[model samples]
Target: MKALLILAAIAIAIPSFSQTLESKQINYLVKFKSTRDLQTAMKKSVMSGTKANADQKVEVITEQMVLVSGKNAASAPLLKNQNIEYVQPDYELGLIETFKADGQDQKAQVMDYLMKNPQLMAKAKGDNPLIPQSPNSGAARDPLINKQWGMLDMGATQMWPVAKNNKTIVVAVIDSGVDYTHPDLVPNMWRNPGETGKDAQGRDKATNKIDDDGNGYVDDVVGYDFAGNDSLPYDKSVAAWQLLLGGGNPGHGTHCAGNIAARGNNGLGISGVAPNAQIMALRFISEKGTGVTSAAIKAIRYAVDNGAKVLNNSWGSMGEDASEPTENKALRDAIQYAESKGVLFIVAAGNGFQGKGYDNDTAARPAYPASYPYSNIISVAAIDTKNQLGKFSNYGVKTVHIGAPGVKIYSTVVGGKYSDQPIPFLAVWEGTSMAAPHVAGAAALYWAQYPDKTMAEVKAAILNSAAPISSLKGKVSSGGKLNLVNLMKY
Candidate 1:
């Protein structure tokens, strides 16, 4: 059963459309007063040629919210009905930063760099490329930990002892699917409990093709793929041809997942801030790194309904459009749902246009979800190892909450690989997208240490513990960069 919203409560102020729906067909998200009202609204649609026509095009995401693929001709009339609260286009959103430019491919640059530097590749493949970690230091022994300047700068070294052996918390990477099999991430991947054991018929629940957990999904051992609408949410990395034609993912979600909770001190790769946290992989963005609004909402709801305590939303619209507020209303509602469930939503402040930074405080249209006025939201900005805000990072003293290591970030990628900075086109990897998971992992780390804290309390501690930094001053709400040691102390 889907959750029912109170009649008196509208998800948010539904902004009126500037013009009538265009005649062309497109996907539109509609919010009806009730499930029963769906039929009544169709009856009232002037373009509803037939009941079957209406039924064929509608995809119900929730009892009240639906994704309709048809012209505004049918939906334009829906607004007249007092029961129909909101209707708007289902906008297509993509990665916060573009990876290709001027015939240069970011992935190509990475491959070229590796090809020219076989020695580095050889070292990458070595079982133990560096000196082993001293046991009493309480630091990770991962071969690449030294390259993780961001983690070290955030005080990961000092906090590791306290975070190690703590309760494992689940943090959902709500983006492209994760490479759950990555050597660095496999040990900390989330395994669905209900789908682990044998079924009533003595069949293995994980492979029995049954909804063993009774959670509307079948054998979701880790997480579901909302984009592909199937079970396996693996990160299908882009091929050479796909990149040439300008499409396919760059292991964005996998990198984010590694930052949140790659296994620590495992002697394989780097350690995340919360090495013990479990990464719940939820794929909403397609392989091309773009996703529709409905899919994003479903991913958020799924993360909350499951056991995820933190949601790392590293993708969003390039910028806010006041006229299209209704288009993203469903997004707000979904996030509100997470908030009601005591889940913290850590969002990227967004990389500005052309991969250059911008000030959200005075921009005509600021990045959203990050700019959204939600209590549970902790909008993050990107900063380099020097504690300087990334030139490509967006900032807002009031909107963006805090700063975190995002520039030249080193973490896990697809194909069981690790890179300090893979996509090299105009510093594509240096984005607030990378910054958010730092906070997400930190949230998990802090929560693990103090399980009694509420969502608001954890958020407060994280923000309050930010170390006042000159670069981030007057730019983010916290006026500082995240300090994990200070946060753990709090």
Candidate 2:
């Protein structure tokens, strides 16, 4: 027995020695003129070290290659032999991975090495696509004002009375991008104090340039255009009639953004739940209202990293098939990371409400991020004015945590662009997608009120304060619809 125990300890000790001898983040970045060159260089790096046991991994990210060593050793010789243009240590982004010495660090190191050895820093910068300039006028407000007054008249008025106006808390809209230059939106836009752009002097003035912020985006002066994968401004567009056959063209995201926090009371079309909160639009979905798991993950990470305390994800699928555990796992990890950073994620339950035509014994339909056990995510369902569940809204006593108004809702629209005119506001879109933003906007209001509340507490306030609705009783977990007035007490 003693001999066996000693052997076990030795086995463990071997891996420990390998781990300790190498630095925590001894990662490398090797650059090639093209992906083909990168592949060749990677093969050479691996082959050069027989018994060296180097591990190479492709970056899920674009524009780079990463190679990690199972055992630490200098990579200079291998890189030089491969005719690689550059090699460097990978720098990490966000506080979470800065010590990993991975991807970004390697890029920086390669750039630095080239500058010192080959004067490569003088190369021309990449051309950034032009972002569409937003108009100066506010969106029309008649519809939003009506919604605001209707909510207020219906006893849903818990918003900060006008006295608490200039709090300027940041609300990150993790959906399609926003029209930042919109006249009304400009006043409430969140400007990064740490961010600088060029001035009229042209003497290296601190301006919001594409490269100036150094946050992996150029001149993200308004917000990022992640779908385009660049800072260039683009509007979300629905595919032609031949494509979707039913859904409207791309403006869902803009409409949702306006619902949450379009400039309110500026004599514009409609008022957002929290008019004072600064909206930081983070576009993840394409104009078609569809997005991949990877883009969703990045958008969530970007929002949390850039000071967005509340994240609004009004899109989600009705859970994965039993065979797709891998996709579920990735989503679970990403959500856990977001919660760890103290960001609240609000997701929409799918719209599949034609009662399954069977008994409830079957497993309740599940929604991806919402159904995931992350403490910050709050899944929402849609309800109509009659306090009845919408025909298309998904519901599960065990899965859906709350309900909100999603029927025929009015909000902002994109491409309402006009000369010296505010964007047009639209009314009467119906979907669970519309309902999710109401909850998200309320979350912003709650977070603004209790800035220090944990994601759990904020979620609790939302669930606990909802107004009971008979129509949704057995279908919804809480048997209630959202009630901002009741939540304010907390």
Candidate 3:
């Protein structure tokens, strides 16, 4: 057994604000009554003495929404324009796991407990090896498969043979980015059809620096990185200290992608719930674990416009802000657009900031995107191996829909590594951030089997197929936990 020591409690300041807004220059997202109304709103701003200058940058996020960045972009005249529906600040967003202090504290507590109980840590490490399993086990051969209690509890392995034969479904991982080079994830990545062949000059279209598909992005072979402003959306790793400071990328997107779709039955690493699905890497969050609403909107639209059938949104805001009631409108519209196009947006139900799960229905403010009341949204909460809700998870009878395995979820990370435990401790790699992907992967698996079903039908199938769990009763609307075998049968 490894020797370990518990540390004394240390004081840490928890930020009250759920989402962050830019501080340098005021950036406003203006949604017009129509696409043509942008010119009129801009003119109204300048004529009304908003001090328009060349320093200002105008980016068209959608046909009706434009991001205006300038010193006085928030002038009343621009917002009150008859042609404009509403104007709100563009918030700097982070991964849902990084915003909560209790979520991080949970990691510290677990580490301390592991230190005090070295035997448990030693057992966990010894039981979960990174080598292939004995063929006589009659299960997945991935060496570390035993540690993925989540997959075992959900019956993901049982549906593997059926899922393997179905057509691939594209799910957009709209978070940090994906390590597409990871051997387990590489086989299931979505490659752009337009960027794969040779260009006009016989140069490789992927590296030719040309927008071959003319989808407005240049050389988006796999997926585009709005955060890094590049074609390759690779999940970048961060320093341990940076994660401890609560402002760094912890290979978040890669982990989520692996949970949704790591290749199966190849005798390599772990398999995702929907091993046949393809991941469309869309990076909107920066390495600092922060991104803006504009980038998020772009990624959503891109996913919908492309062939993506489902979007795994594992990041979202906590509470409501009185000052920015309208801040959610932009995201709401983007999600609504996805719904209109028959796409499912799976989201995390969010974690508590005070060290335990909270009821979102009665809270002063519930989580957004999850609680957006959208028809296409499936809000997921986290459950442990014992079928008990995680202390750091959030739940709501009407808001949160179902529970999935979130504790100690083992999957892919950056640099071809796989772990449920991360250094500097981030939710112990737990939280709804880990839970939502299970549902997303389930959605993909079900959709691949029922390709002709509508998004609403898919949502219904998943909810109706849940396996009732006593602990989840009255907490999630489904009153049960995610059952992949049942979902596949549907």
Candidate 4:
């Protein structure tokens, strides 16, 4: 009878182990109103002495206030006492280990814990919208003469004349979705081999289907959309700015994309700095120009995981709220990861018209991610045709790294369109946002020439090649605008 009991116990244990093996780890994104609130919660959790067993490990990463742990029955009491806002489980892309707790019942427990903590939930709810409704309204088409002159006379000097163009290098443009069907861009767009679909003729097709490649994204033929979380075709909406202060503008991203790699010398309206390099569009910012730090982090990670050698971020914010610790750490970690993966990151120094003295005033301040420390991140400012800094461009000798042509510049637009307008072309759309891409494109040219150069070398080539601008002396680090003509010599 004793032997029979032992055999029954062993049989029950086997099934439990199988269930646990298939169980998935749960990730919880917790938000607090302020650092004070976040610290309070952490203190409470620690004082409560709610500890996990040897089989479970609870890691609360402060950067994003994320708590990751293996699924278990004990998570409920600890979460309940800590006042968590939302407990979204199994929302991550990949599969992980499971626990022996009741799956359905455990999910309910987690949800209930969140519901009981209304204050935490309210605080966690992000106010930053995915799209902005009333963005900076301006004329779309700039004059043709102005566009033409700016393209030819001002900094029209070619930078990649003698260097061997590196076709193997890939750049990831993380912004509003790219029109892959655009004639100038179709040939240069990146495609995922593992997730491509096929037609009846057995030819590869970009389709909208879920899990076709078992990568968790449905019909992400070109790239995955974190905003929508599904394969509905991404298009810019006018109302995207309400979520993020300066978001909800796809025009900015479209123009930047064209500058980097828009199929040069193909009878197109304008040519890119590196015509042969490939462009990968990663849409982290929605059509309405607004995005949170979390979404940006995910996009950075995605670009690094895939085959992006360079990453461009041309957006930022200015204010007291911009210096949140959680968001800062996330940006730092992401950039560090990119550096480790041998990828280069370029960001804008903001276009808020503020000087270096205005940063700590607590009024409208300079933007972040640009301010973060990562050797690979190059902060850029804007310069006009006269080789003088744009009035509205932000500058800091300690922070702003370099300057590039931004005023009256023309490049690619959405919907397979080209800006045919002339120099000083499209009236007055000038900002550091526009200038950052020039540096990014130049980086591509540098990468193509010295494929073996470390990130530091490529950075030096860009700074060392800048043309001296007397007007910008003492305002910018290199004290000049980028000179493509001089860069090719290296």
TM-score of 4: 0.65
Q: lDDT by residue for model 3 over 313-415, one digit each (tens)?
A: 9887666454443336777789999999999999988887655778878876567667878889999999998999998889999989999999888999876
Q: Write the per-residue lDDT of candidate 2 for residues 1-490, one digit (tens) a residue.
A: 0000000111223334334434643444444445676666556655765323335333432233333333353323343334444433332111000011136665565445544544322321122333333345443443446554325532434454622544445777766566664555556666654444454455332234435556676556556666667653334544222112223234555666766776665666665666667777776655544544445556677677788877777666543443321333434545777789887888776655232211111444355555566678777787877887877777767667788877767666554432111111212466667777777777777777777787788888889888888877877677888887787776
Model 1 lDDT at residue 446: 94
Q: Report the Cα lDDT for candidate 1.
A: 0.76
Order of candidates by TM-score, top first? 1, 3, 2, 4
Model 4: per-residue Cα lDDT over 1-490, one tens digit each: 0000000111224334334433544333343435565666666656776544445555443433444355562243334423343333212110000111245675465446545644323311122222111122232222232353333432433443465665677777776555555556655666665656575567544453435556545555555555555443233433211212222453455667777776655554555666667776666555544554445566777777767788887766553142221334344556888989878898877655222223311324445556666788888878777877777676767677778877656777655565522112113445666778777777887788778888888888888777778866777778777777777676
The true-versus-predicted C-alpha distance at residue 122 of model 2, in Å, is 45
lDDT accuracy of residue 285 in candidate 1: 83
Reference-based lDDT, each prediction: 0.76, 0.55, 0.77, 0.56
Backbone Cα, N, C clashes tallied per candidate: 0, 23, 1, 35
Q: Of the pair 3 and 4, which is ahead by lDDT?
A: 3
List the pairs of residues colliding in candidate 1.
Answer: none
Model 3 whole-model lDDT (C-alpha atoms): 0.77
Candidate achieving higher TM-score, 1 or 4: 1
For candidate 4, what is the lDDT? 0.56
Order of models, best lDDT first:
3, 1, 4, 2
TM-score of 2: 0.66
lDDT of 1 by residue, 349-410 (tens): 98887768888778866787778788999999999977889988899998999999998888
Task: Mark the regions of model 4 whose C-alpha exceeds 4 Å error after superposition.
Answer: 1-161, 196-205, 208-219, 231-247, 320-327, 353-364, 420-427
Deviation from native of the Cα of residue 30 in model 4, angstroms:
5.5
Candidate 3 error regions (>4 Å):
1-24, 39-51, 75-81, 99-140, 164-167, 325-327, 424-427
